[model samples]
Target: MGRTGGKGLSLARRLYTSRILGLVLGLLCVSVAMYPLDPPAWVWAVMLFNGLVWPHLAYQWARRAKVPYHAEHRNLLIDAFLGGFWVAAMHFNPLPSATTISMMAMNNVAIGGARFLLAGAAAQLLGVGVGLVVFAPALVPMTTPAQLYACLPLLMLYPLALGWICFRQAYTLGLHKRELLALSRTDSLTGLLNHGAWKDQLEVEFERCKRQQTGAAIALIDIDHFKAINDTYGHVAGDIVLRQLSKMLKQNLRMADVAGRYGGDEFCVILPDLPLFNAVQAMEALRERFSFLVYEQNPALKVSLSIGLAALDPAQGDATRWLDDADQALYEAKAGGRNRVICCSDDKPRREVFDSV
Candidate 1:
């Protein structure tokens, strides 16, 4: 409710500013039209109140209302009615009358589209009828050169201001849309790509590798004995370990590498243009680095990684088959003892053991 109120207040303030600009210029146009006839003192008083004072009054009315949106909308209708009254009061002087009506119509359309435009038009017609009853029913068809020049400022400047406001709104909405899309694709915990988003990228990488006939490798990394870590040191420490690994992946991989949290204590990486041997060496170095990390919660705690690597095979039918190969290699790594890298080739799986210092 507070947020809604703030939005309403903001809208009311914008409407207030727009009214000030429109009415100030409008007053000049109307004053020029009525000068030759020497209208009554009351007519001048009304014009002064509408041009100089009404914008502030309308703003206060909307700001104080229980629902400012509805109040501001009602204020717009009043603006339309006043515009009609002025047109009739000017005795339908061609330049001022058309300018007044067209500006009100533009305001109505901008605020509430076609429906409000029609509603405002009806209100203006009613004001014209009231004017005919109160003042003389007359229309002056000719517009003097002075009147044409008087209408110029509102005609040129008001539309420009309105267009700028609309463009700003469009640009803001586009930024919000892009932010939402990025959030949707990112993992909440790791700030990396989520599982589904990573799979989508995997398919794209697979297609690229097949088309270009380039060497690329994918690795599935699992934290050995992660469930035991969570059980021994609590989930918070386990979360710390996961975050540290994600940080390492971000720091070690190239900009082109696609890394993601593949559920539980497992992560996935797609290394473009890298051979199986180099990919294994990279994973082994990452594993050794992660093992040396010291946690604040547990000084003696130790962790190790089991990594499975697979190079893109020309004989592979689809991305799913390629993923299955990586998964098979991961199973072999787990089976061949927990802290090692296993590479799956077209013929057989090979294990690489390294010092666990």
Candidate 2:
């Protein structure tokens, strides 16, 4: 159920209505369960007045300020104030009404018991405070010390239970947030880091390389003549090629390596704590895998990759330089011939000649 907040009606209205129904039903249960313990008529009158006043004020406030209330915010100010009213009203009657406070706390737990625990605890505490204020005179008039001491436990217990429940809910919410963050950083198609996520990861990897006094390797990969494949066959065939290439890279890479799609047919691999020799070996494995993969559309037609690799110098202090060098090496590979790996080193010309057919 929903309602409008200066827009079309939202499901918030239905949800709000349902919460109200639950609250009313809970009160009815408490009333019935505490049978023969009815409070004075004056106490009922005060509760009736409060039932009208608090909701009316809340509705007017929601209307004027355009607050959206639903299950999520069901225990917001209005609900808290109403729950407080229950405590104070019960003071006048002092019927067996502990259930009201318990019900308010339970309502929050039903929605997301962990995420909104603090708010629920706060609400419960507010109810406790109201009960104290309402029962102050009653406490003074009690003839026996046992009677006063008996009520003391409930005063402390309500908020304590609420606090524990809220803490559990909050811890669960934190775990869920972490899971969501990981999913957001992952690429759905290639099972690699997305471009934006890769940049952040590269920065961390670069820092780690600098601190550990280790060299890192960056490889830029381009599927050779990918556009021709898409043009010749349909997009489905093109998608199959991309998926196959991604699978080849994943299968060939080591556990420490990270791969990401740099956009279009280009992909980047970050090899942390790797020297030039090992990086070359990894690229060789990828090339070998590519050579063996049979295209589903045409097994006779071969597919290949052009790769550029560069080893980073810790003294350079620029991760971007390594990527530029690798990109330049890739450009050379594509120019000389595809299906080859080229290296970029200061001592070398940053190029490797590939034999083109």
Candidate 3:
């Protein structure tokens, strides 16, 4: 079935189980409270129906309704009403009366919050009024020891069960929230960090390096002749190449390294605590590995990467300046020749050291 239908079914099942447990305990407590008064046979029959048959009837009614949620809510109100009726039948014995009313109130609040809780309380009062007319209106004002002891099980175990259910719901919602956040930050195509998320990480890494006075490097990588590949071999084959490059990066880089797709045919990397030479070596390895990839769609198609490396420099003012340094090096790598790595040196005129493949 659909998600809403499934949720309705689950809620119905939960209500059914809780009703069985609650009614059984409630019947026991009420029976103990009314034993001394010698309740009639019809009263016993009604107790049997409420405690034994009503849970099943409520389940069937809710499951068959157009909206099980609404049906179950009505059933909960009925439970509160019946609890008040029983309280009146027992002449409002202190322990049994309080247990029945409090349990029903807790159920109403748990299911539908404060508004429904108030509504259920109103329903209970209506039942009490009806009982006062049918039965005696007097209050017992005292509970025997047996009635108090009988209420102990419902008071203790019911709350624990309700608390567990609420905790499970909270934990499931937390898991769903975390999954959504991960999807939001990840690229759908490459399964890597998207442009915005990667930029955020770059800023964090920049601040970290500045605070710790440690070395780190950032690289900008572009697929050489990517548009030509797309035109000649089709975009599908170009996508395969991009995915292969991302896979290679994941496999070759250290676990601490952060990588992302900057945009079409371009990627970015943050190598924290790594020197420029080491970053260049790592990028060169990735480039060589990606070059060896053979596409099944077009065996004749070949691709290469041009990467630019820049180390964290004290002279740089902020993360943007560091990114600008890497972009300048990338421009130099493309200008000198494609399929090469260019490292930017910290100097007035910014010298580039080119590493050829």
Worst 10 residues of 3 by lDDT: 1-10
Q: For candidate 2, lDDT tens digit of each residue in 1-357?
A: 233365312324333444444444434433333223365676555554444444444444444444444423653534655665555544423332444555565556654466665676677567657766654523222123433343444444544554555566688779989988877887777777878888788888888888887878889999999899888876777788778878877877888888888888898999988888788778877876787788756776577888898887755567777778889889988987688888876346545443333
TM-score of 2: 0.65
Stretches of candidate 1 exceeding 4 Å from the true structure: 1-7, 346-357
lDDT of 3 at 350: 64
Clashing residue pairs in candidate 1 (N, C-alpha, C atoms within 3 angstroms): none
lDDT of the candidates, in the order given = 0.87, 0.65, 0.88
User: What would the TM-score be for candidate 3 when compared with the true structure?
Assistant: 0.91
Please report the candidate that would top TM-score against the real structure. 3
Q: Across residues 274-313, which tens digit of lDDT does each residue of candidate 3 receive?
A: 8777887898888777778888888898788899888899
Q: Give candidate 1's whole-model lDDT.
A: 0.87
In Å, residue 234's CA in model 3 sits off its true spot by 3.1
